[model samples]
Every structure is written in structure tokens, then in C-alpha cells.
Target: MAYEIMFASFTFFSIMRYLITRFTIPDAVQHKWRWYNVWISWIHALCAGLGCIYCVSIEPTLLNNLQDYDIRFAYNLIEMSTGYFWYDAIDVGVLSGSSLKESLILLCHHFVVILCFTVVVVTGDHVPIAIVCLLVEINSIFLHARQIFRMAKIYDGPFYTVNKIFNIITFFMFRFVSLSWMLRRVILDRSELSIGYFILLVTSFPLMIVINFGLFLQVLAKDVPAFTVLQKLQGSKNQNRKEKDACETLNGHMNGTHQTKPVMKAEVVSKLE
Candidate 1:
């Protein structure tokens, strides 16, 4: 119940943040590469999160159905032991994996978790994981805030001005509040040590780092057009400068010739008169 309530509140804030972002950024920037990366990410997140929820609901039968309890238990231990930790780490990973393949990836994760739980099913110990997920969701809101302000500053469109800074600051506050709350819990006890444990124990963090890098790659791709335009403008300025220099050189040469030929022109005019 604590997890659900906390997560619910976080989700509500995320929804509002999305709305703020959608309004703040220009349609161009919002629909561009960064936007698409986030879109796919959220889609995958929703799918995986929902599937995990489903697995949670049916956890009772999962152990009974397993052919080998020990194997199932091992899988469950590895999966659950490092679950939340892996997700965050992978979010910042070097690989984009597949923007379009979010659903499939999440399904696999859900299956893996179910298999892990079957190995050693403890009926009542789910509360801690649930709370962790809630806190993680809240912390993720911070990730979005930076991009929102960065894009707004670049585009100067929509609510891209002063009021938007308040929204950004608010996002920071929410993140600190939620993250500090989770950190406090973890700091005081061994039971709440999943995040720290996973950080030390899992490869998921590297994967998430890759994903963040990939997202920036996408953003760079979107900026390519603007970059190209700037390059063209620069080239045009250089070309104009070259033409002006050539014209000035030609005029100067003609002026010099006229000055040198003046004596002969005057002599010819006197002879004609």
C-alpha cells in the first residue's frame, strides 16, 4: 500500500510534468529526436511496469507451476535482488537497444522476474521492492527536468520564459524530497539496501548509461538540420567576402591604369584641337 500510494503520487507528478514539458517546448523541439527518445522510453516503461504488475498479481501460482523450484528460485533471486538497480543503470546505458522494441524487452524482464520469484517465493516480502520502485519513479522526474529547461532555453517558444523556470525548480524539489526519503530508508538499514547493492553488483547501470548516451545521439541527429543551415550561412558569408575583395582589386587596377595613361590622353586631345 505504501508503494502504491507513493508510486501513484509520483505518476501523477510525472503526468503533470509531461504536460508542462509539452506546453513549454516548441512543437519542433518537442517532436524532434529528444522527444521521440523520451516517447519510446515512456512507452517501454509503461509496458514493463504494467507487465511486472501483472506478474505480481499472479505470483501465487508461479511457484507451483515451475518445473524446477531451485532453478526458478535462482532466477528469482538474481532478478529481484538486482531489479530496481538494473533498471536505472540501464536507463543511462550506452546502447539504445531498440526504441521500437520496448514492449518485447519489458515482457522478457517480467518473465525473468517471475522465474526468479518461483525459486524462493516469500509471500509477504514484496513491500520493500514496491516502495523502491515508487521512489525510483519519483527520482526519474529529475531526469526530465533538465531536458525541459535546456530545450526551452534553446527554442524560446511556448512557456519558454520566466514562469517555466519555476516549474523546473519545482521538479528539482520533488526529486530531492522523494530521493532523500528513499536514501534515508536505505541508509539506516540493511533491508533497504537494494539500490546500493545493485549499484555494486549489477551491469544494469552501465546499460542505462548507454541508453542516455544513445538519447543524446538522437538529439544530435535532430540538431543536424539546424547545424547544416548554420554551416551554409557561414559558407555564404565567406563567398561574399571573396567576391567583394575581387571586385575591389579589379577597380583598383583600372584606377591605376587610368592614372598612368592620363598624359597620353591629354597630348592626343591637344593635337585634335
Candidate 2:
């Protein structure tokens, strides 16, 4: 069933990519191939994100017993994602025009994911842990959206801004926070896990941390400039507000002095009379 679902998932994404490229994306769009590639990825992220959430929601206790808990849907989701990664690895690394140097990191990432997922799918152990890792796809949903929007030439707007914020937030939550929790679980449950699984977890954890941190820094580097521009705009507004208040204060003082002089002259005239 898992292998069947895995092959089906791969075929489904391939068909979707074809249909999207054939009918959905306009001919006028530049880099149509890249768009379709990212489009499929976005679709996968949406599916995988929701699927992971549902699987976990139905069996919240899985987190407590990562080694013991097993659910059919969880296995299916892992296989499904594994299929997508396989497709992506081929499409991006082999078919795309990108140089090997440029595609090296991404290919390596896909390789690691497929390898780990294959181990879990074959052994039927650590399905819960795999599901937890799939939770990172929740962040990928936003991460891919950022790419789609950029491809669509939507660098800034309300929609883009909101997506950007969510992208950064989920990157932290799912990637950093969730991965951290999983690391803790692995450490605490080390005795229960098999030697192979334990070794895999220990080896993968540092790589996951380094890769995610690097990606997080890149995300910050890309998104932080917008924040800096916002800060500059805000500072200018604040400065203008202060200047307006200062002018108002000067006008008020000038008006008070003029009125006081008039009142003093009136008093003097009354005293003279």
C-alpha cells in the first residue's frame, strides 16, 4: 500500500505539472518551466502540510511515543512526500538548465530526505517521527508561495507582505521549534529506538539544524531589507510629526505674547482713565 501510494503520488504530481504547464501558465510568462516546477512544489507543500496536520491532530499522542505509534495516514503522507521529493530531484537537478554547482545543495537535501523516508517506509519504524518531520512542509507552504509570488513579479503588496510574515514565522515554528522538539524526543527515547534509527537521527539532526539555520539566515537576508525600509519610512514620519508639533508650539507662544500685550495696554488705558 505504501509503495503503491508512493508511485501514485509521483504520477499525480507529474500529471499536475504537465497540466499546469500546458494550460494554466500563460505563454507570455518568462521562465515558464521554473514556474511550473515551483507550482508543483507549492501544491505538494499544501497537500503535505494539511495532511501532516490532520495526521497529527487525529493522533496527538504520537508525539509522546515517536517509536511506538503508527498510523496508516502517517505512513501514506511520508510516502507521498517521498514521491514528490523524488520527482523534484529529477526535475530540478537533471531536467532543469541549472548548473550542477547551483543545484548541489538542493539535490543533496532531496537525497537526504528520500533516503531517510525510504528507511522509515521500509522498516515501518519511526513513522511518527517522520510525520513530525513532515510538519516542516507547513512552512514550505509559505516558502513556496514566496517563490510563486516572486515569479509572478509580485515583490510587494498586502498579499505578499502577509505571506512573507507567515513564511518567516512558520520557518521558525515548524523548522526550528518543531525540529528542536523532535531532537529532544530522540534524545529522551534513545534507549527505545533501534541502533540504526538512533544513528540516523543522530546523524540527521545536525545536518537538519545547519541547513535550516542557513536557510533561515537567507530568508532573513531577503526579507529584512523590507523591514529596514519600513523602519526608515517610520522614522521619517516620526521626524515630520515632531517638526509639526514644534511649529504648533512656536505659533501658540507667539499668539499668547500678542494677546498678553493687548491686555496689558487695555489695563494701562483703564488706569489712565
Candidate 3:
């Protein structure tokens, strides 16, 4: 049922994007096939965000037991989001015209996520998985918004800055807090999970954390700082231009006074003679 819903949603969104973008969205057309990949990401992020919210609202204590939980529609929805990633990994990896390194990193991330989610779903130990999804997917909405704004050439605007701020805050809140919670569970909570399952969980979860942390640093140290410097440079240019204009105006006034005084002095001398 989860697979069916996800596959159907994926197919529906793909065709809908084709029709809508072909006829309606000039921006999508302008981006060529890359826009379709972005649409896939956008839809997945929306589903994941909503699914996480619904899961937490209904079962606030779901994360209390990492290894035991009942499987619900919320889990299915979260599982369905993995299908989008799978589809996108193949789609963008094959057709998105991105660089090989870029494609490989994206595919690697998607593959790891799909594997982790599959293990949790199949083993019916879904509580920690739900927590992971809640942490990871909620912030994706803002991340995709930043991408969309960049594609639309509005990335330097106020709205994009707001979205970036939200992205940073949510990333820190969800990723750091959730990882810390999961680490505590691993150390303190004993579960009947298979050795293989435990190993996979332990390895994959932290690997993702490391990758995400590196990306966060890139955003903090590289992207955000570049924008700040650019704004400062622009401000400096404007200030210099204002100072130049003021000096030019003062010089003009001084020249006018000098010229008029000379003319007045000539006239007074002629009258005296």
C-alpha cells in the first residue's frame, strides 16, 4: 500500500509537472529539465513535512521507545517520501544534466536514506525512524524554498534571506537535537533489534549526521558569508559615491564665489578710477 501510494503520487506529479510547465510555467521551461527535478524535490519535501507534523501531533510519545512502535499511516507517509527520493535519484542522476560529482553525492544520500528507511519499515521498528524522518524532512521544506528562490533569481532578496534563516534554524534544531536524542537511545536503551540491524542503524545514522554537518558548515562559512560581504561592498560603493557628489557640489560653490568676487572687484576698481 505504501509503495502503491508513493508510486502513484510520483507518477501523478511527474505528468502534472510536464503538462503544467510545458503550457503554463515559463520559468520551468527556461530551466529545461532541471526544473522537473526541483519539482520532485519540492513535492517530496511537502509530503515529508506534513507527514512528520501529523505523526508528532497524533503520537507525541512515539520517539520514547526507539525499537518498539506500531506502524501507522504516518509511517507509511514517511516511507512514501523515500520513494520520491528513489525516483529522483534515478531521474536526476540520469537526466538532470548535473556534474558527475554532484549526481553521485545526491544519489549516495538518497540511497543511504532509502536503505535506512527500508530496514526500519521492514523490521517494524519504526519509532526511531519516525523521529529521524521528523528531524530530517521538516527542514527540507525551507531548503527547497531556497533552491526555488535561487532558480527564480530572487535568492538575494528579502524573502530568500528569510527562508535561508529559517532553513538554518530548523537545520540546527532538528538535526542536532534529534541526533543527540538518538545517540542517547543507542547508549542507554536496550532493544531486541538484530545485530545486523543495529549495526546498519548505528553506521548510517551518524554518517548522515556527518554529511549534514559538513553541508551546514558550507552554508555558514561559505554561502552566507559571501552574501554578507557582497552587501557590505555594495554599501561601501554607495557611500563613496555620495561622498564624491558632496565634494563636487562644494567645489562648484567655491568656484562660483571666487568668479563672482573677481567680477565685483573689477567693477569697484573701474568706478573708483
Question: Top lDDT: which candidate number?
Answer: 2
* Candidates' C-alpha lDDT: 0.42, 0.86, 0.70
By descending TM-score, how would the candidates be arranged?
A: 2, 3, 1
Better of 2 and 3 by TM-score: 2
On TM-score, who's better, 1 or 3?
3
Candidate numbers sorted by lDDT from highest down: 2, 3, 1
Query: Which predicted model would earn the best TM-score?
Result: 2
lDDT score of residue 176 within candidate 1: 44
Which residue pairs come into collision in candidate 2?
Answer: none
Question: What would you estimate as the lDDT of candidate 1?
Answer: 0.42
For model 2, how does the per-residue alpha-carbon lDDT over 63-131 read when each residue is reduced to its tens digit? 887776656778888989999999999999878999999899889888888988998888888888888
Per-residue CA lDDT of candidate 1, range 131-197, in tens?
Answer: 2233333323334443554654553455444434443353344334433443444345534334545
lDDT of 2 at 223: 79
Query: Residue 161's C-alpha lDDT in candidate 1?
Result: 43
Residue 94, candidate 1: C-alpha displacement in angstroms = 7.6
Q: Give candidate 3's whole-model lDDT.
A: 0.70
